[model samples]
Target: MKILKLSYFVKLSIFLILPFLCFGQEKEQKEKPELDLGGALRFNYIYSSWKEEQKTKGGEFGYDMFRINAKASYKGIFLNAEYRLYSEAFGGGFLKQGWIGYKFNEKNQFHVGLVYVPFGIKQYNSHNWFFNITYYVGLEDDHDMGFKYLHEDEKWEYAFAFLKNAEELNFGGDTENNSSRYSYDVVGRNKETNQFNAKIVRKLGDSIQHRIGFSGQYGSLYNIDTNKNGNHYALALHYELNWNKWNLKTEIITVSHSPENKEGQSNKIIKMGAYGAPYEIAADFNMYTIGLSKKISVAWGPVSEIEVYNDFGYMQKKEKEFTDSFMNVTGLLLTAGQVYTYIDYAAGYNHSWLGGNFEDDFSTGNPDANWEARFNINIGYYF
Candidate 1:
């Protein structure tokens, strides 16, 4: 039985209004006024430990998800706001951005309340929505009602979003209790979903970069109600080169997830499940990763440039759910002292965001393995 179609909100609102009706003509601008404020201050400390074969636990912490934001403009009409603070006590901070914008210039623009989803450059998905409660850590701080249309000219950049949320939040923790009890019925329960995402980025001539995207989500799990629906995707390609003092980079990412569709948009109830479970106990899930980065500069004096990175990926559990399929490999080392002022050291191994090989509870079957031995240091100062 297959009949999953809902026109995905009219094909993502006609791909964000056909690029504003093929560049919705607009010209003439003489007025210009500005008062854009800025704010930033961050401090974080973490210590972790773990052992699997014999069982061991670990911890160490220090945090400050501090933030301050401000914005105001006249001519293109703009206004922005922010406030965040979270040091501990269940980590709660809020108000990350306030929006009000109008601009059909510099490429294109349109805005509406509480914004932040500034595609990539990494923040685990453009820093995860928004909020300004002292940069709280309870979980990406909810709040999304949606409307975005963006264009970055120079080589081509695209972004289209139509979001909605009554509820859904994730800041790590809760992968079905992390295994045991027959892998918790083979992994189940952490649901509270609602998502719809789309993205595209391209620039392939001078150094190369490419990305394609997708997103789908519908809630219910935490506390169990079972209306579930989830689908997420990605396709990636990248390359960066700069020879003179040496600099090179490479990237590849492919991911997929689909399952827990309990007759959503039914055509005879395509309840779906059992795809071998990997990728969080899939109804369907796939993964791929490859990374390489290198940078070298400072020949002598003022200590700078020295970076190296490596990554590998392989994951399993989608062989129709019988289980047993895993692979992960990773390595990273970094050093960048002078300019940008810090980050004197950084290290990693099996660094995960999807490389630890399954077991984020996969809905509850209990699969666990997340290895890491990382250290970072920074002395902060930026005028």
Candidate 2:
């Protein structure tokens, strides 16, 4: 039923956009409609080190995601929208991002609608499949429903946003399973409203680029204790540097929040979509991620660029009771034109949401929760 609903909207959007975008292609098009009709199909083979019997530790081929990227402008007014197909519970067809903006000048712009929050080192920060810990915590590349002011110059950049919620159009319904295909409302540990994101960054040096950025967010999280709103604030510092064939990215983030918990069982985890315990509480946590990437140019074969990447993230919950989790991802990526192939591996704690984001590694009985590893080979082609 959920798949049907998502599919309905996806197909409807396709029917509506195709003719309009392709209408003037054959004739002398003045101001060509900037339309990008392409998507990636992927094949994956995965293996789990500890769970030899895990169902996801095998080969699978399916529609990973299909997107329609379209933008048009006349005068100074512009419109942009991207619709994609990918989700956990159902065949999710939703906008990865969409916004309307007007350029005030060469360096200033005002945009409204769904926009990316100014919270990460880069828009798409990671070089591998699994992003940094900020993504797991609902901060990296988070698209929110809101308004924004963005500016960029040679040495400085800024972004400020007033968002209503993260992702205005969410997948329709209650999801018991935690998957990247769906939002992380599994046990409802997080409820967002009236979020404000701010950031400023500057670059120094001429040859070897050195950049530093500061980001912060303040929002209200709905709690069961009171009809009033709860408080949540996050602060992060990011540094990125590139020289020769090597690039390094690092970030340190701190976040604190106090949200109302379910009555009576304030200590127990309210498990629903995820097998792990829920963490919707008044606690603070610190996260740090550092990654290095080196590009090797290979001209002989189909591989145009051979890249090696490794990134690790550590999260320490300041509640003094919660355990810390570690995430390490390493990858070898081969890029040829618009096609990419990669072999990646990740190791993390059980029930801590690892690389195989769809599969939750939770079990019963004989405790001693240990770390697990997942290895995957991915092939993707974008048309």
Candidate 3:
């Protein structure tokens, strides 16, 4: 067995400190503040029709999230805050987005505090509550304590962000019930001190539009050694086509990571699952997600529209000993009034987070037939 060497207070100060200083300077010169208040009380229910357990189906119903958002602006200094109370394993309910932003003009802006990492396409990754496989890889709603700068124009977009503590905000660690899980960082679940992300996007076409961007990440994963580092980078392509009442969206994302370790520092164990053990991450891993979805207006009573989507993902380590993983999901999402419903069927290796705990439950004695099925419906109400 190979063991991987496992690789804060000043960051909170840096994240919140400079923003407040700028806010204070602007606050004194501002005359009046504009305030806006809004929120959503969402209820979610899930019924799992079939899974790996060689047994009965599963069902769960309860409050998914209760969110409250507030925004205020005075003399061009803006503050946005949101908090959530959520009961979900696929996602967490915590300071969703709280930031102070300054708009230099119509095309440029700067923000600080907890903000979005501005990585993959939102539609493909956010089709359902599970948020695709990227969320488990720390690219979906993966907010960090940092500073960000954004510039957008009619045809070009540019962004840069410096972040602290990668995948530090995580949910779901219990492998006890063989639960399908959501996480902040399961693959590279460590505090990254110097994480930087940069991307430049170009828009092509008039109506049938395509947007492409090259992105890179430079970061260090620190837990065991304060000096050892891990690095990863990726490139993404997103496309959107719009018609009168329908639109098509698709995205392709590929990422690669290289982990380094010194001997004897591999004592740290992974927090959960059958994969949990002395983690040796000195190898390279590559993963990709490809997704396509179309939304059409269906004038069926109160039903506003319907979305049809299919997403696929694959991951494998460069080394031959570890297993390769993948998932195939096809589903329909229905929007009626302020509520949204998802009917999805997923098939993949037992190693998929959206599928059943495959390593724990084996349908066939052979791992090759470890394929599993999950048909689930998630209904949520917004208020």
Candidate 4:
């Protein structure tokens, strides 16, 4: 009789507290946040037609970069960041992008910190590894210290941002803006400031889709020497099409800058820098770009898919005395599990990163510049 009474008492105690225990577990699960961390390692092989020695040696292979990506979310708050490490000759190591955001609902959100400028096409404007000519001019994939508000629905998307300045390298009190960064910015005596951007996109169709977008930007150019602010503005119109396994992109952009520089300095040219170097770019220009791509699925071993693309870009300077710049890239992308590779044949005329000298290629380009070509292969492993 005593043993039966003891067993009954224990069973009654567990039954009385079981509901509270279940409730607490459910609440804890709901409060827990989600986190994801990932990274990539990449390498490159190059055979430049302009580099005689490299071409004679059958090209060169080297380490490209290593990068880390992190993301976290709790309730309606989220964080995202990426950091990259490159060779010392490049920009060394730097934070690519980082932002904290809050979602009010499914269609509205706010972001702060270093955010991408809402300009041009979304994400990348080109399918090739070299991107388009707009990237070198700081009009594509550019990021700044800013706050952004975004709204999206089934057929429309809109974004507005106000950027105080570009990302600063905080070394010391007299730290000068340098080219040790991932994106191009005004890095000499002048800095970008008080920039505002607005963008809207209209989406149409489902299986065969079309997207049309318009973007506008205006910013102040703060010259340290003059201590007076100048102004710059850009306008862009872009279109994208997706039909089955084929995609197409095209854009037209016009940009102009009026900077308050020191005496005797040319206002038609501005100093822009990135990847450990500075170069001059024309202050007023028009750019045009177009790209087409087709995707194919494959059953080859360790290779699941392939995409073939061709991208072309042209820049025309407002100053008639200055020459023009153009680039064309034919490439294919291969994806297999965690590995991705790009094989590209790129040709350019008066392009900065191709073969022309960096100082004036994008400013007063060389009229006698001949076409230069580079065959490159880049492979990356992602986790």
The best candidate by lDDT is: 4
Per-residue lDDT of candidate 2, residues 251-321 (tens digit): 98897765565556342222222113333322467888888999999895677899999988877667554
Model 1: lDDT to the true structure: 0.38
lDDT of 3 by residue, 258-314 (tens): 444355534222212111211122124455666667788889998989988787766
| Model 1 clashing-pair count | 34
Off by over 4 Å in 1: 1-32, 51-70, 79-139, 142-359, 362-383
lDDT for each candidate structure: 0.38, 0.67, 0.59, 0.92
Two-way TM-score contest, 3 vs 4, winner: 4
Using TM-score, give the best candidate's number.
4
Task: State, as a TM-score between 0 and 1, how close model 1 is to the true structure.
Answer: 0.24
lDDT of candidate 2 at residue 310, scale 0 to 100: 93
Question: Stretches of candidate 3 above 4 Å error?
Answer: 1-31, 49-58, 88-93, 122-126, 167-183, 186-189, 225-283, 356-369
Question: Which 10-residue span in candidate 1 carries the lowest summed lDDT?
Answer: 126-135
Tens digits of per-residue lDDT, candidate 1, 1-383, equal 12335567678889999877766533223345667655555443333233242123232334444566678788778887776665434235555456687888999887766544433222231111111111111111233445567777866666665544321223343443221110011124433234444445555544444443332223222322244444443344433444443333333333344444333432111121111232333333343333344556655565565554443333333444333222222322233342332231222222222234323333222334444332333222221
For all candidates, the clash counts are 34, 3, 8, 0
Q: Which pairs in model 2 have colliding backbones?
A: 87-181, 88-181, 176-273
Which consecutive 10 residues in model 3 have the weakest lDDT in total? 270-279
**Native-to-model Cα distance after best TM-score fit, residue 70 in candidate 3, in Å:** 2.5
- TM-scores for the candidates: 0.24, 0.78, 0.73, 0.93
Clashing pairs in 3: 4-266, 4-279, 4-280, 5-265, 5-266, 7-222, 7-223, 7-224
Which ten residues in a row are the worst by lDDT in model 2?
A: 357-366
